[model samples]
Target: MKKVLMAIVVISILITAPLIYNRAKIEWNNDTYEMIVPYEEIRELAIRGLDTDTIVKTLYDNGVRGISFEPTGIQDLVKQGLVMTLTKSDLFSMLQKEDENTRESILYSRENGLYVLLRNDLDDRWENAIVKSFGDRIDKVTDLPIFKGESIYFIKGISKEELTRGMGAVANPILTRPIGFDENLMTEFASYGFEPVFRIGNNINENNEYVLDQMKQLQDKLGGHKIIFTGNTMLGVAPHKDLKTEDAEQYALRLVNEGFVLMPIEFTKQDGLNIYAKQFNNKIVRLHSLDFFDGRGGYTDRATRAVKERNIRGLYVHVADIKKLEEETITAEQSFEVATQELEAITSQMADKHQPGIAQSYDLLQASKWMTIAGLVGVAAFIGLAALMVSEKIALLTFAGMLLVAAGYIVTGATMFLQAASLVVSIVAATWAAISGEYINSKKDMVFKFLKGAFLALIGVWFVMSLLYGNQFLVKIEEFRGVKLLFILPIVLTFLHVIRDHVKDLAMTVVRNYYLVIVAVIAAGLMILVVRSGNDAGEMVSGTELVLRQKLEDFLFVRPRTKEFLIGYPLLVLGMYIIYQGKGWEQRIGKYLLAGGAIGFLSTVNTFTHLHIPIYLSLLRTVYGFVFGALLGLVLIFLYRLAKKYWPMIQERL
Candidate 1:
């Protein structure tokens, strides 16, 4: 019983192995910094093609995650969910509430999964009042210190776009906030998994004994919490020269060495070595594009060359930018909502456009490589197996067909037509030889076998005709080079089986008259080529961008109909039809003929992109092809009926 149970468990493990193997997960390592980029915000930047590096910095400063927003409250009248907004009335009410309820509100705010911002610069006496609102539940704020404001002054009467423009301004209210370090906030932050951030003036001495004293005290209490240095370092200058800069870097380096993270909050682009990389040599990881958050275009500083060369992490945007959007007299919640929606739309669009196609292209290339190797092995095995299973004549033919297919594939990078033609030829030959060998031994049902052969012969003749004509047309088109061996050849063999049968039985009367047919087609093709050449006499010119001139140059000198098309046409049509067509395959056969004729006509018509064709001439060319195809179809029908009428009498003598 124990053995049985162990066996079942092993079987289950085997079944589930593939699912585990293929699961997608985020890859992280010490060498490769894994910054969790908020994808949605990044896309807005991409659409505008703005600076990417600044976008990343803004996101990190704001503590923004790529998560969707949850509704904050229900609208009273409309009964719809509303996002949290900043308003004087709400701030006043929340502040006026007892400390218990205020704390309760803050905890509840987080409980509902929405970010809670403590209204700012209210007096310390009011802090007790705010604390009374929550009672003992102050510890319930999970995942961070309560974001506080030193001075809670609202910008008066400004359009949201104008405020967005002011995000980079020195006069921005966000810049003037007083610095305060709270030990209580730090304790509470550790309990709730939030790192306490202190805002200090950019000019604060890095080596200041007071700041070091405060950091050591906090480190001792919290066991190691990051101190966020918030200030703008002057652009295009050495941060080391500034006393405050040296202190900030020293503090960050010491903390980082001692298992603490130092995050500097800078409003502008300046060198601070928060994140260092070989690609971005000597530059600090800080927000850039301090110009403005126009909402239309985001600020990004990612290198374009970098994007092309390496995998990108993601993008970020400032939460203040989202909030500033609401200062347009609209609620802050509504502003965040709009920004969130915009972010989602942009990210979705970018992912849809780029990911799917790139993935498919990659997968196809991989499959092609594996499939080619597997096919070669399969061919070799089949040849060996056939030599043992069949007569030398049939096995040799099969082997020859396989070799041709392999050669074609090697030369052209594809063997679809060659492989298909080989298969058809092998099957038809094997069947014919087996039946003929049986009849010669037994002398039974020879007439029936002969009839089948005659049918096959007819099929082969049709296949040959189509292959030749199609190749003639295909070779004329510049794009049809490698396509012939892989596609056109096999297609011809598919239809040639009927002719093969006729040849096997010696019932083909068409071969006796094949010379006459070939001569007639050659004559017609020559006349058409001459007429096409004559039409281009004056239109063709050297150094011209005209389509006719370019085509004439090609047709006259390089890859002319006489050399390539004439030889390729017969093989192409015959091979293509034999492979692609089925019994009662008139429609399939017709399509092949039509495609060839269409190419022939289209080749002569000028298709220069820069050179515009006159509307009248274009219309004339369209009508000319239509009339030509119709006439040609009619003439072929007449020839087929003529052949059918005399085929029986001529076959009797043969």
Candidate 2:
């Protein structure tokens, strides 16, 4: 009775301590930095070969957060000094109203000190039209295409197709506004050697289905470098009360699922923008426009305010009228200072907002095919070792083996890759140490007993570290409350074996009465309810990410991490008969596996209690593990009885 009580007390401590330690050790992180600036601003600074800090500081100071003007032939114009004229539609309208020809328009632009950049959706006959109307030479924009002639210089971003063949293009891909054909036109353009830097999908329709479909198709074809934007997606009025954040979040998740990797700024006043910033900070580049040389300085202040308020990661600036911007007294130096100061402020705030939450642990098994196999094999070896009685010397060797393997994994930098293997090692060592410590206690050898208990305690520490932080020594806070039956089952079973002699009669009486089977089944049902309650809950391997684990269960007719249900519980029942029914290896092995049912019961219910896993799914998984495992256990028990009866005939034949 004393031994049984001691075993229970020690097991109780062993099970809860690691979980508490792991929970206490978790760390959570929520810090991100993102922004944009103009192409010319980034280029001019880079070309000047300024110090990197100076460049970053200058860009940030100037409010250059997100879209840096992509370096291309535009720098050549920047060298001649940039002056903006009317937009394409406005320019064409003015030409029609004034009856001015292309040459006269170019000449008028030059007189205003503007560099005329032609926006050509202009038909292929533009050269002939210009020649007929203005009697001027029209140049073909080719690879190595240069225009020194004071006429209208065409300024579309040169594609990679042009650059690879000794031609110069803008560093960015051109914006392709597909006509009525939509993304199909984009496909047509890509096939014909047009590479868009980013795609803009017009999503202002009654339902955004067409826009969403086009974006998905474009992302699939265009690849990673090209980002697709949902231009005015849900373009209704903002202050955000009208715009649902949930709707925007769904749209964002859908875009990511479909592989659109970046986002541009839309309506900023909406809290939905913050949702986007939180959800897609790394995946999407959300921009706040500073509008550096625009006529209104009012836009600049609002842009800064939005950056601070919404945690918007990047800033963009597009200046059309340099002359109009001068009236606001916004100098290049002043803008640079403002951007740098704002960026510095954002950085400072990011540092403060950081809290020591749960440390993150990545799944080591999910990374590679080879590592996956290694983990599964490790589990097999661990179960094999844990199923038998071994000497104290063998237990010490097991302890040393875990240390050696962990050391090897660390040196090879494969700790994360061998996470499951490391976990098995730690568990086996801890289990053996615990059982050995109890043996020493029975002998009343105080000094040796203390030493064994100390070793067990040390192994317990290693178990927590290996299971919680993993190989990378990082703890993801979400793991704090997660249950790991991997450690709990084996070690608890080991201690149960140490108490078997003391609890034998009581165990056999229950088994002989046929009550153990009933208890195991009832326990399975009750555990399902405990799984619904947070504090008392166990665990199950739930969630969609456990892809391979689920696959193995489907293929093998046994669930992964469910050995306790199928193997452990049935062995417990079988062992009860074997202990008194037979002698030799069968009896001894039965003694070793007698705790399987108890361990199995734990395996079923706890598998569902994984912190983030849904309760309904967890219940279904637990029930399946229990029923299947119980059925298999019955088969093994029947087989063992048959083998025992046939042993005399088999011996005579041999």
Candidate 3:
């Protein structure tokens, strides 16, 4: 009963804790940052293009309840049913509450799921907020020639003739897919306080299903009321060719039906591109005149006022049979509420990955590494390990001698280590320690012990070298590269210390005979070349039919999949079998093989953990890796047994 109560309490906290504690999502945008509630707080919406009425009702009909009318309050709806939205009243009510983070409201959308914009809201009112933003920079361009018409236009630097001539030649935002206007005027328009919008297609036939479908595809990429591009004639060369009214009407209807608001161009003909948009029983806004930046016309204040009054949305436009607007579409009074709550997400992700100011563009310079003192760390650990295997006094004396030599090389320097020199010296020391420990502890022949230790020490050297930026694996750990040292070194070193048993004579004999050494040198060299070149060999060795790692990466077994299955799984399975079935030295060697195999699986798993890879793809890769790897192992095991049986019969015949 106590366990059940504890379970219930945990589940309840999971369910209701969000309501008790809520924080607004802040994201990096422009040069500054903004909370998802929108910086402007004017016509800015907590979420754009959401149709809450039908969604709540449908959910309630299906027996989901405890949701209230407002986004926050005592009877409020929860964000993802985890974090509860709180009001100012809710904050004051918690008089004991002190953390400022929990007091902020939250915004959420059902369709987009935890939507947050990393950019500023820009001016929805368009009262020169953009002009004010770039006080001096605005002076660099010529003044906008204001034209008052059915719509108003600010065309100064760019002439209207340019609009007439260039629309077709220059790419339309529609052809651009994101389908809205901002070309050449994004910073300027944004300065005027206009929402940043991508220009989708400009030559959309409202009547054409294919054209409408294209519009829909773009709309889905950016949720809700993002700006769109629409024009009557070939975008620039226009005497205002009108699309068929029926076609215009259908285009408008379909977009609304599909739950998107139209951001049609102003003065679009054939019913003026008015979209009568209603999605899931909620009205959407359409913003117009975004193309004015690209030398298209704008609207008069009266027309702009009318557009605002009708609750149109744009950052620019197509118009077709709009209205049935529920209200004036102001952020303050309308149904679109930006409140605290609905920001419930995995707190860990929110803390680590979704915090504001982390959304800046990353370049190679941003990823540039400083020289790490990792060689010293490796050196210290190597000395410590050596001390355990030998006498502490002897190990310390040797380490002191190496450090004195290193210090001599760095005379007058503040630090005692040089990056390249220290790396080489550290590798030499680690190799000596690792090999010496193995050589002394094992009763195997001197040559085999030396060979085994030498091979083992290569791993340590690679690990120390991984401190260099060039050695880090770009994506997967399963790749045969220096990155494997990060995990492999520690595990192997641990077992060598703890599970020191008889060494495998057969494996040692192979390595000592120089045959395996030659093969391994060739294989290891090829692998190094592959990694050092970033797997793009076309630069170094070019010709038709000459395979590049980039090209090889596309095939199943040849790329990541092959690395995981053929190399990783086989080692894992074979190692496990040997550990279980083989005695003495074979078991010890099996541990090493198993460790190697594990690297493959882990690297592949790490590849999938990156949020960029789709969950389905990750799943597919994992399944393929395991299944194919097991089959390969079974085949190898079968072959080994077959050979063993046949060999005994042949020996008897001989």
lDDT of 2 by residue, 1-654 (tens): 224423532453444444334433331121233344444454444444435456654544433333321211223332444322233444445445444556354434332111234344433332233223222222332211133332453333333344444655433222221212233334543453333334344322332244345445555675323342433433222334654445556766666566444545534333344454334433343445655445455453344334322333344444322332345455544545554665554444333333111111222211233332333333333333443355545544654455465456556754343454434544454454434423221223523532443344333333333243321222111232423544354536664664567576455653444666766874674465335434223455466635665465445433434455555445554554455455665565545554443454344333432322222334455556545655676688689878868989999999
Better of 1 and 3 by lDDT: 3
| Residue 562 CA displacement from its true place in model 1, Å | 38
The residue-level lDDT of candidate 2 at 528 comes to 51
Question: What is candidate 1's lDDT per residue for 492-511, written digit by digit as tens?
Answer: 33334333434554443445
| Model 2 per-residue lDDT at 249 | 69
Higher-ranked by lDDT: 1 or 2: 2
For TM-score, the strongest prediction is 2
Best first by TM-score, ranked: 2, 3, 1
Error of 2 at 406 (Å): 30
**Model 1 stretches astray by more than 4 angstroms:** 1-179, 183-201, 206-255, 260-268, 271-293, 298-316, 322-327, 342-654
Lowest lDDT sum, 10 consecutive residues, model 2, at 357-366
| Stretches of candidate 2 exceeding 4 Å from the true structure | 1-565, 579-588, 595-602, 609-613
* Candidate 3 residue lDDT tens string, 572-591: 55555555566676566656
Each model's lDDT comes to: 0.32, 0.41, 0.34
Question: Could you tell me the TM-score of candidate 1?
Answer: 0.25
- Name the top lDDT candidate: 2
